[model samples]
Target chain A: MTSVLGPLALATSTGALLIVPLAPALRELISKRDAGPLVTRKDDGNISSFAASLRTRCISLHRMLDDCAKFGDNQLIDLSHGSAFVVGQSGAWAGSHHPVALVACAGSVELPAGFQSIADFYCRGNVRCGQQSIFRSLLSEEEIALGNDTQVLRWVHAESSLSAGRNCRLYGRASSAKLLTLSPGCSFERIYAPVIYSSTEGTALNLRTEYAPYARLAQSGIGRTRVHGAMHFPADEEHRGDAVATRNIDLEQGACIFGSMKANGDISLKERAEVHGSLVSTKRIHISSGCFVKGPIIAEREVIIDSGVQVGLPGTPTTVSAPLIHLAPGSVLHGTAWAKTEGRVGD
Target chain B: MLLGLFTAVVALICIYTIRHYCFTVNRIIGQQRHPYVDVDTAEWPPVTVLIAAHNEEAVVGDILTALLEVDYPAEKLAIVPVNDRSVDRTREIIDSFVVHYPGRITPFHRTGGRAGKAAALKDAMAYVNTEIMLVFDADYVPGKALIRQLVAPFFDPEVGSVMGRVVPLNVGKKLLTRILDLERSGGYQVDQQARMNLHFVPQYGGTVAGIRKSALDEIGGWNENTLAEDTDLTYRMLLAGWKTVYENRAECYEEVPERWPVRVRQIMRWAKGHNQAMVGYSALLLRSRNVSWWERFDGLLLLGVYMMAPVLLLGWLLAMVLFYLGAPVGGGLAVLGLAAFTTLGNFAAFFEIAAAARLDGSRARIQLLPLTFLGFTVSAISVSRAAWQQFTSWIRGQEMVWHKTERSRVAPVVLEKSA
Candidate 1:
């Protein structure tokens, strides 16, 4: 019994030692190096990354389509997923009806009035949509012009410029590189452009601010209260510091803050209130009329931008993002106005 | 008395285990709140990148090279390498970089007025004029967009400090480095993100982090008296109602200790520094008003992390003593105790590491999860020793010295940008 047990014990011990450490050792020392290098981009997890990706795809597809033939006349063009009707030169629908997922156009095309196309329409040249035309998405390389009461379900991107007519509903994102003009009563979720005219009722406001009185929040506070407590800027003084509030932080009319502001509750910026920084909230964020917020104004639930409110400057742009965004008439934003759920032009 | 002590230890351990479990779950499926992730275009503040060096001759040049190529405005950026009383070639190499870069590289050589990183940082701050001071260890390699990512949170006034994720670059070097890489993935990928998501206090580790000069001045700058000045500043900023934000996307790579002795020393310093901070701030944290109840609760648990080592040992000793006493250490209590002992011990951390690996999309390395026991054992022993030493030193009125981990990098690292 002793002779048999001794060798068995030794073998078992050796096997256990060898096997237990071997798996980890093998994994550590001999495993394939598959993990990519850790790197970060400006748009690491941006909501607008999807739109950027679509543009990137368009660039590659444009290169691929360079070898293909262009649409000569109005005909039934068969695609991989579905078919597309080539519009006549007079900008009228040709085909009987093709409910396709992807509608790729080689040249400029205009759908007939009252058409509902649940497809991502692409155009190399300028494209125009008819009245009450419903589209899944629109990606145009040159320019895109939507007719009155047009509804875009997902997104619409124009490499040059995009204009939406009155009473239009832009569901997801509407962007352009040069300029984006939206007539009155056009509701939109996300708008991105160098110069975005949301209302077109008023001209752009003067954005350059003299931040002389508003010093860095650091130099304003004494060493004691600078950290030991939350800041509540005096309405009279033009403070330049980030301010956090446990409750509502209502900036009085004509209040100027050179720093950002965050609150647990609502943040109400009164008329003519100017904040040169961002504003974040757990609940609602309301910017009153004649206010200038150079901001990426982010809110958890809702955001209301009043008339004549300029969100960002011309040279240095910012974002005004929320789940629900309400843009009053004459609301100007230089960068992006992203609404996660819903947005309305007028209350 | 033994039974009561045993019960307290078990209760404390259970609370930590549950916290870890909850954090892991929250990290996996919770609504990830990255409020400042999208601020891409802004007039970035002039920042001073302070590289803390101590006998780091082999690694200082790499970080400087990396910082020069960072995606920040050249006019607004300054690189200040703080050489903290090194007898080696650290000062010589940094001075050479200053000569080469001319206006971009500024070296601050500290010879007098106290030792350690905190003191070096305090003395170095006198020369810098930038509002945002970003600190990095001499060995860390930062990404291109790291400075911008770390600075985005400060756009919000509430954020006084921000910490980026620290990834181990010297992975595949040895077993210890691999384990540390996994551990750091867990610590940053899941643990820090969960805290940021839940609106709790995420710790501001000294390196790969930045603090507003204004907030630092208000928080009394660095506490030179404490060994772990970073931990000390984290809690102080908390007590003062400043939010220390964490950006997981802002990643930087550092060379982790490759050998056991180095790792033990590194952990020992951490344990001592963390415990010292806990002793200093635990009571004050509990008394801090206007802060959320969850913040206070999480702060206390985070402060007591290193102290768990001694408590874990005490529980084992009490179990042995009760067995010898022939007491009623039987029935359901015994099973539950043993279950928590063998099964639940460090399972929270294990679950976290596994989830982090899964989240990081490193599925192949998850095969090594079973071997973390060896790493944890060494850590547990080192922490236990450090905690004991820290406790006794307090009783004996002795001060703790800053224990610098000996860097194993024999050659200067090459700076490479992926994006």
Candidate 2:
């Protein structure tokens, strides 16, 4: 009975709980921004800069754009647009032509000039954008082909970024940029433009892709792809084998190349992909069946290679600094390798 | 005998607990401070003030004049008055104001009493283009700062209705009226203050209440069938999950019914109306997903008050009768104790009212607290009449006459319109 009464009291006092915390949260959810970025046209009746600044100040303060106010020297014009971006009532537009890198971990991307249609899009309104801007998803071949059934892909700044004909190469080198890795397959290329490697830090890589007609990489900008990781694999479009320079083989399933693999990071290779940079890690690098690579491999602990392996130049000797080097009869290797006095090969 | 004694002890404990808790919560409500987060009032949207008057010639001119004198943007303030079936010079005054205050005052006079204030308001809804709309009765004389305080809560989007403090203008008229005024303050300023501090208001006071126009439309307009349209509208809004805020800062002085019979009729109509609404709206209130459980609890508690007050009154009379009928000295002492408890309960409510009036800069009324008990006895009789009306209406399944509170003596000091 006491237990029942305790719960009853708590339930009865639930309103006190709402008053303390939930009211503010609810208020935030319901409140709408009164002003957004201003979009102006040139052919307006005589308006002074003072008036424009005053208008901007007023617009910035409203929860929603309503009537324009003319205070002292300022004259405000109400656009009543749901969302807006300030493009300077009069001046140059900065921050354009830069590579738009989107970090999608739960944040918002605001559009300029309280464009109702665009604001409606962000709010998940049913209105579809026709092909005017670079951010609209309709221009993408994948979205067009799927038609009414198009899923919401990665958010884009403009709709102009999608195309199908260009044969592009995945760019980025592995060294210290551990987070840089090519997305598996070519599925996302349709939505997010062609893959271009960028160094997490400042560096250069001479990327040469044969057979692919368009092979230029992004050179600079915030979103420009670069090489960061040292040791990683590069896989072919199809999941089969790595893109070895000599063989042009497709990579195995779930075995896309990763390099600049962080110190404790280990690769679980269902079937190993091609390694393009030096593998420097303190963790085990697992190489499964059908593994093929061409890179300087280094690890602090050990390297596991299972089944059908091909490594290094034809005349290179295999080197190991580890105490023991264990190899299966089926495992093959070719490299200039050596071990320290305390280390041994072929355990 | 043991069971009866045990029940009496339990009842005493429950009454003490409930009253003590209510008083404690009321103190917290009285002391609550609005957090100043530096919200720019300049960004406050333009509001259209709408007052629907029917034969309100006595007060219409003053209300219009006061409205124009408010410290807000003149161009943004639009006073729209709908004169519905006014048999007096109300239309003439409205016309004079309209002509004098061109573009600021818009008067729409309806000759026929087609639907009432609700329908008259519906006709003028199209003209309300601003972000907020404040509604007031003809008998109200709003303070200069009233509009600012009333519209302040619209900054909070969840707030659908804001009820202003309704102080009575005729508090000095008679002892009974003064007590009635105190009672109104206790209900509006004290009970509502406590409810708001607890994050819920049971009902929205009709005059000086500002409502979001969209919310008003969503609730399908006011029901003409209910006697207390304001209460009916408030219940619907709560069911729709919109928050109703009570602003002690916003003030409007309205006329209290001078005569006891008139007051009884007014309260009786209110009691019957709210009772009907509670029965009609219990499911909606209970199923509401938006309002807090406390709001629902308070709403239920308020609806039960009328029934409980009458039952308690009857029990008091029965105890006195039992004492006179050869009861023991101990039983007589128990009846005296109950009377003392009743007097204290009444005083507790009156104390809050006096405190509220004092806080609101109406210090003159604070000295009248000693004679407040005389006013309470008269009010008790009036409240009993209202409860009796509700009981009879419920028993006989009869419709109640919507008694319009007489607005003869209440005069507005300033005209809402410029003229």
Candidate 3:
């Protein structure tokens, strides 16, 4: 029996080697069954990130949940039903951190008095604390900005409490406290300590008009991060010439950027109208009947000459104003036209 | 016992092959190809369309509207609908159409006194004073140019009957409906065409079948004795030295019974009718004076096979057991028999149905091919039920009900608003 078993085991090992050649092809077939193209950044910024763009764009919370389950997303953010939470592993494909770390309300958050900044709010009469310490009465913007000075911190002291807790800690320096560099001999512990914040200057969370590359700071596993207020992009004619080529812009209707469209030419849009493309307005600008551009239009503001009227690329064409422009007898323009005064032929 | 079973199996195989050959050859020559002479559309004979209707309120008006919309000459075309005591608004709708059509329409109402589809049709035959009688079921939606196609074969003097292709409507409603449609596709596309190709184009399905009015009258119209007067008449026509032709292009979309119970009843009725035809026409086998020897013997054998299907299936099972017991090589023979029946024969039919459904420009219906196997199973039940009905009815000396399949509302191709 031992001799037979030894031979059988040897045969099985030989068979295993044969199967190694088939592994890659079988894996390829299985992977191909559910494969999809990787998402990429594009002209349309509505879903700037590729992954979010592939989503069904389902607005309803229930529908979104169903879609998430059906499509089998690696991670899902549940902001649909108002209970904000971030799910899935955090970090990025690179060592770079994922944009979202914490998700909070869209608007301002209230903080207690005496905390001068986000840094001040995380620190208290801190010396050293063990795991699972309950920091009570955290500073809120209302009390902090109003200088009420009533909030305090109470540390929790329990061994088992740390297991199921949030497992998060805030590290920052307080506004009133001096920066203290601890020495090797300076070891301290707070068993049961309560520290109150008292300061005339306090920090308040502000709703800003613009949020920069900060929106990408939120990491998946770590948490969600949000821009409380609207994000603004400031551009002027003098500063806009850095890039000759125009990037296609997708206006998220909710964001409502005034100059929302991108155009290789000058943009000339109708008053109180919406354009979905970049308008490149050249010397000859012609608008045909029943054409709607949902983007920006570009046109030259100085002398430029072209014969094609009402003929332009798809999306919005950039409009350029010329010193003198000629129009056919039946040409009509609806959007904005750049000119010196009463812009027309030979302005 | 094993050797005996083996001998029986070999004999059956030999008989099956010969019969299949004859069936194939007859269909290819007479049914598949242009066996009948062709006639010019300009010289096409006047045709009277006979519509057998029972409680068809939903689609009766559409049928009339479609008939009126047919591109045939008003003088050449005549419509006579035999209203078989419909409790619904079928008669009222027909009457309205008649009032609107004036001279073009003739309505026949069968109120009482011996009610059957054949009887109604026989009574209505008096109104068809034309060379050709194209019979359409209430559910049948005739193509605009169907009359032209059906009559095109009449140019052939020997062609007694021309069978137009019948398709199913409401094919995408459910799995059952889809399967039913696939079954239909299998029949019209594969089975019918194959038989035509092989030479034994079977009897024309009732809907969209065209009969020479004079020939039908000479054979005494339809025989009310059999439930399936269509198959019975077809066999008689062939026996009478008249050739039956199948025209695949002349299309008609017939509404099928979507409900399982209704479908069962419909199949059972068909089965019983076919059985009666077989039993009554079995004598055609012995008498080869009028028909060819192949026609007489092959026709009888075909009918016999259809009637004895359950018996054959049982024999096939026994043959399997005998082969497994190692008494003889019956298992190999059994496998060959099954392979021929399913793969070569039935699979070809399935492929035809799928192909035809697609060619007919119905993508949604083509998707129903996957459920066709289930449809075939259900159909076998109907066939058995039919056989049982035939046996029981003969024993009890009672006739079965002739149930009519219901139709759905058609989508109007031309939706014109009133000025």
Candidate 4:
């Protein structure tokens, strides 16, 4: 018995040493599928209900402006490609040609100069427009102050009265208490123009559409554009032919370009350079202090305007469109600036 | 009796070596690849990201920043940062982010809970609303395409979980990290991808992986008892008849421990948890109707990885004792053959790492293959120690205590500067 037990003890100890670490796992493996709960009762909750609650609080593009100082006031800026909606009694500031949907506005609506006809206007406020302003349809709640020679192709539903100038034509339905000075040869078309009202409930429009034409044109012009190893147009070389580079274009200090400059990559303009024509790049465009671009500037990636840089031609509406647009303090943009991402305005 | 013990030890070593050789050969010859699926960005579903952090104030900020910078649509993405009772500035940093990006970042603070990552994740699981839940370790800095690439596998309905490749960020910092980098390459580039291609069980590493919320709920969320929740989930998901995939393109950078002691502790913890998983799942795997015979075989081998340390140590001791007693260990040719086979088996890992490095275009790093033997030695000791502790704790009916790896105070600063 002693001899048998000696080997038995040795074998048992060794086996236990090897098998003990694996025993718990073995037991768990043999147990029922639900023996060990993955989560306890205290940790369980209605996931769908929680998710639904979170979905309601999800951030939309409109709520993104909550932290911006511009949204603090009752002014609506049309930064998106689609029309901007003024929910309550706010002032409409149309910075771009994109249409404006006014639910109600306490102050006057400011439109760009020489704005003959807008895409559509759903006015539920008192709108005061300048001379020769044509609106496709005017659905006003209170009043509409139009200038001389205005034309409305669609129906006009004015709750109060509409004061129009001389020589105005209402093509479809006109239901207004007051109609100001009537000019001769004003005829209404029998065909009723359907009131085109855009939806403001969905996601903001893709701002990239504003640059699609320019992008397509730039892509096609790639073959014809002269290729240079580098671009450095000094002030002394202002009359040098249009600078074009397939790579990078670097303008030295006080470099003045009298012709259009195109780059496939980045274009960096130093201080006090004057570009008489357009500056276009497939990548980034950096304009430094006191530099001036007389024509439109377009970049596929980013456009950075340093302080005191002036973009776009004077008194003419030019456009600067890119995915990212950075505007430094005191920089001047004389035309429509469209960016997919929110413009970073530096102090 | 001594001769019998010698033969048994030699036989076990021969078996282990042959098994490793087979794996190495299979990895080299296998042309298995994961099924490709083209996913459109518009079809991407809403995903919730959970990052469980504890005393990771130094590196948590970088991961959060990386998460925010990923190319996923903001409205369809939600980030939940779980603070696991960290007594540092981790909570404060998370709080500041929550304040800054309200609604985008939801902060979940656990004041009273079990002190482990599984427990923390279990608590965070309640807040996950999206169909997909992505988890990232606090130390990981995910690439911009991480979210897009990780979620792409879910376009296949059968896939329940997805794992991404992990690359050590500080590979050139020290010898230990360099060795770790080699190990990572071997583990991800060869072992994991080969397993995926061969239709074997592919593991879902806790970080850099995405889990289907429904699948997780069906399995009752994460099991807080197991130290290796990731392994436990991988097995449970498989048992529940859900497929897991490995995505090679979804790569994320993680910080590996630079110090030897820290590496030892980290490896020990892994060994303990993995061994625990082995004991718990080996029978279930063999008995699982969901897996094929080949899968069962591979699963058991993967589980028994930590046990090899003790088995090898015991074999070495038995051989030494037999030599001292002048016992005939084996016939001359048999012993020599066994020695050669065992040597080949031992160097199989080195070959795998070298192959992975070559594939990754880092041929210069393959020169450090000899130094990996040092890493293996340390891992062997750590695994043995952890196994012994596990056995004692099991006998005494005591729960294994969780040991947190101490974070390098200056590593994050260096990483930030480099970035």
Best candidate, lDDT: 1
Instruction: Give model 2's clash tally.
Output: 68
Top-TM-score structure, candidate number: 1
Give lDDT tens digits, candidate 2, residues A1-347.
99999989998799687556545323322341111101111121111222233334434433321111111111222335422321221111121232222111011123232111211121111122222222222111111111111222323212122211111111110011011111111111111111111111101322222212211111001010112233233444322211111111223444544221222244444564544323333344556655554344443345555545544323322222222223322443433222211111121
Flag regions of model 4 displaced more than 4 Å: A1-347, B1-29, B36-42, B326-338, B409-419
**TM-scores, each model vs. reference:** 0.84, 0.50, 0.49, 0.54
lDDT by residue (tens digit), candidate 1, A198-252: 6666456554443444344433232322323233444545765667777777787
- Candidates 1 and 4, the one with greater lDDT: 1
lDDT of each: 0.78, 0.49, 0.47, 0.64
Q: How well does chain B match by TM-score in each candidate?
A: 0.97, 0.84, 0.83, 0.93
Q: What is the lDDT of residue B131 in candidate 1?
A: 72
Q: Which 10 consecutive positions of candidate 1 chain B have the poorest summed lDDT? A: B410-419
Model 4, B1-419: lDDT tens per residue? 75676567667666656655555566667554533211211235689999978888988988888889787889989998888999999999999988888778988888887988899999897888877889988888877667877876654334579999887776666667767878888888877887786677889889999998867877778888887888888888877666678987677888789798888888888888888789888888988876767778777877887888887777566656655665554444444544665577678767778777766766445666666777888988889998998899999999987776676645443334443
Q: Lowest summed-lDDT stretch of 10 residues in model 1 chain A?
A: A220-229
lDDT of 1: 0.78
Better of 3 and 4 by TM-score: 4
Which should have the higher DockQ, number 1 or number 3? Answer: 1
Please tell me the interface RMSD, in Å, for model 1.
4.2
Instruction: Name the top DockQ candidate.
Output: 1
What number of clashing residue pairs does each candidate have, in the order they appear?
Answer: 1, 68, 98, 3
